[model samples]
Target: MMNINEHLLRTFEARPGEFLSGEELSATLQVSRTAIWKHIERLRQEGYEFEAVSRKGYRLVAKPDKLDVEAVLGRLHTRVLGRSIHYMNEVDSTNNVARELVQQGAQEGTLVVAEQQLAGRGRLGRKWHSPKGKGLWMTLILKPRIPLHFTPQLTLLVAVALCRSLRQITSLPIGIKWPNDLLIDGKKISGILLESSAEEENLNYVVAGVGIGVNLLPDDYPDDELRAKATSLAIEAGHTMDRSEILVAFLQELESLYDIYHEQGFGPIKLLWEALSVSLNRPVTCQTPKGLAEGTSLGIDESGALIVKLQDGTVTKWYSGDIQFSS
Candidate 1:
């Protein structure tokens, strides 16, 4: 059963540029003519433009390129993930809002998407570049049944999903660098920040913060220093991308891979992650709380640890770290 907004939007989409009278819309939606007008006004607030005549009801004059929840919802094919979505024009951080939603009893697969983030972040407290309408800034809430220690595997799994989706949508050579930084042509394009809460023993929930540089130009970077190390979908694809398309594809892939992870375990996901990793066999250094360890990357274990052969002829698995590659 589709909601009224969805039904109304679909009707307008099916008959693009055609005018439907108030009586027609009211009959089709089984609502009063005034109700239709209210819905149209709400959509206008969401950045949809409409043309109204004396007799003709309304016509969609133009659709804003801003984030459209209905656009994403119409194309979403996932079972659990992204079933409920909240869209914002700008947020301090999607993760912050998502954590609040979780505390307010937001269900699993609930998503918070923003067109821009004021305080966007990456792993290790790094500031993520998210300009207005130039990136996908979102936080997905999850309550996976997996144990606390193995929760890190979700980061790798999401990387695989994102890699497959971006490749399918934009045909970009996206690969995962270590835990969850997405790269193309050896420059960063996306990053994932995972935050979770736990009870005395069991895990409570996880908030996966994802930022994808969609249509950012070279000027969106905070400084020349970051511009040399990061790229965007528009830059790599040579044109502006339909951010909603990428969003739907990402959610679908994530849900599919997430299901596989819960049913079959991390072995299969680890293989897919390794296949898309760019850090394997590279000279890398991991900065843990203990200290920094430099080694050759040997890929990740089932527990999502980076297996490394240290500089002193010893092997170590780092569960958490800031990874940097040696050029």
Candidate 2:
């Protein structure tokens, strides 16, 4: 299993240029020859390039193109957020993997990151575009002691943190679009999806999944219509971006803001979120299950609900709705 992979990885790192014979590896690892062979096969399947000669044995050649974990860990300044990272080159979804870890007793601040997602998703079951080596797809597991009703505030807090991080790293003007979308030049660049599990009166765990379209080229977008509505950091900056640096910066920002929210309350974070919010004080139309409500955006409530002030001067609080700007 993973133990064997770790052992092989350590051995390969220690003596990369030298070849270790099958018998020598079996004896050193204290495993059967069949086991060592199987582990090597698995490593090959996992994208670790290896050269095997008949009598000379196996030699590690190259590593898979992936996110630089060392670079990310080196720049990471938080005590949490990425203390323990589960990195994958490819996965179904980081959120799904993080949820599975939470069910198996993963600690708070545990992060699951993937370079590519085969089945990534956004809110309301919408498909999220995730091209390999082009974006950041990560999920963080959190176990807060707060009430279940207060969980939604974390979504807004993350939005503010992402906005700050993006500002620090790039010159692009990034803005928060309502609940959890991040926009650059009035086009979508990133989104956040928050899923939670709760007990009767307490919160069990929450998984906050963040997807940033970082290094995607303009031509990589699937459709022309969608391309007009979507954008990436590379497109806006006119250059390729370092995913490791951005990911580390984002984790640090999230950890700092999360500490503030846990110690004080959502009041302070809400103020920051509102300041970066682009939808407030603008004419907007919200699509609700009931019907469409057209009004000017007021602000978010104490519980993070979107507040809309209708033309009739009646203010309504919306818990879940699709928001659109009105010209």
Candidate 3:
């Protein structure tokens, strides 16, 4: 069956705020008038509010005040990141939706974005605050042919891209907090989560989900303790930001970096990531599931693992761990 919602969305965008006659819609869609009515009802049920005038027709009054697909796709300048966008007004999670689509054979570079997530998550399975119309919750699917071991490079690539993009767009002193978190003045501002599907010798795809605390007010965070540890770009910048613009910039940066990684490998990107890394040359304590270790952060290896120089002048490589700076 044809996707009625898709058809309605396209029609609404083509003739926004203009009356679209039911008969004309039926004729154009080649469906029965009953089907057109049913689709209209479904769209209304899905939060699309329209004005039906007597004998005039249906005029799209207001769409859900969420991330408009037209607005986001219009601002996108990349050929891939937003070529296939699945925008949701309210979803459980963009990563969850992206995973389901990947299972259904969705192509690489497909993006799933949600204005609000009921159960958004971060690394280590922590709950991410995703209030409505406040933050950017998005997931991008990538099917790189690279080996499974090289997947960590993707996280590093995203971190660098986000830091650079934020620096260019906002007047915040954004810095990377080791592995994947973006921080401004020692508080969390954004995070990146990379989940991949791979077999022993081959790789299927990678879902890189990024959640940015953009335009969220301090009061938006319900928990007092959590609010103290988290901050948003809007709060830091003291004004509301166009989340669509930030999304487009981040996607463009990701695409550019991905192209570079695919063509030249992680060598050049690693250099850039290290240059922007705030952990390097700083005193830090690495907390792993095994134990706690203290060291002076040296840099990252070619595999994207962190290099820590211990007090004994011995350098150790860490694959994965929660890093805490010791001032």
Candidate 4:
């Protein structure tokens, strides 16, 4: 069945900046003019701006700065990733929901998104700040057939995808801080967390949790610690941007990158990740499960491990850890 709202949107999108007459839309959608008017009002409440004429029709003046499932889907053009979407007003965490869905046999490309995450978490169990209608809190479920040990490389792939998408949408000097936290002008603007369930050497499922500070204001991070380290696109761009558009762009980029990784391997992904890394050749201290390894960052190795040249001229590889840099 044709969706009434999507049908109406397609008409406006097909013309873009031109008006779609009420009579034409009614006939095409097989609905009454009154029903069309109600749908327009519903979209208006969701942040879309429509210019209605007495006898002419309605025009899509602007889209809202919020994340709407239909809005994101309309802009998405991906073979995989974001084929199915689960949107919520609030949740404990999109990652948690994605995990549950995967257990219930959710397929790859399934997505879970929430406007706010009450128990949002980051790497090393850090609490992510997710207030209502402020940021992008979502997770992607992937059922990659790659070896279980290579799953961490997906984090780098996600970072590269996000970097490409953000670069196209805004003019901010975004850089990938080693691993997958995105930084704009030295402050963290986004982060990626990876979780997977696997057997000894085989693969199962992977969940890539992504939290982005989009259209957020200074007051959004009330905590002094977060206020000093975090920033939003709206705060840096001097204005708010449409979160839905950015989400669609990200999914498209991710889909492309994921295809590349599966077919061409991690060589291409590592090159792009290294080119955009801010930690290379910089002094750093990584706190791994073993202990602290302080050294100069030598970039990542083929297996996606951080190569650090310690002070004693010994080089060590870190697969999982928290990276701390010196000023």
Highest-TM-score candidate:
2
Q: Over the stretch 158-225, how does candidate 4's per-residue lDDT look in tens digits?
A: 99999989989997889998889999878999999999999899889999999999977887786888
* Candidate 3: stretches off by over 4 Å: 1-65
Pairs of residues at least 3 apart in sequence or in different chains that clash in candidate 1: none
For candidate 1, write residues 144-187 as lDDT tens digits. Answer: 99888888899898889999999999988888998898999889
lDDT of 3 by residue, 164-194 (tens): 9998899689988878899998899998999
lDDT of 1: 0.90
lDDT winner between 3 and 4, please give it: 4
- Give the Cα lDDT of each candidate: 0.90, 0.89, 0.87, 0.89
**Better model by lDDT: candidate 1 vs candidate 2:** 1
- Per model, state how many residue pairs clash: 0, 0, 0, 0
Candidate 1 deviates by what RMSD? Answer: 5.7
Q: Please, what are the lDDT tens digits per residue for candidate 2 over residues 215-310?
A: 888778889987999999999999988889999889999989999998999989999989999989999998887788899988999788899998
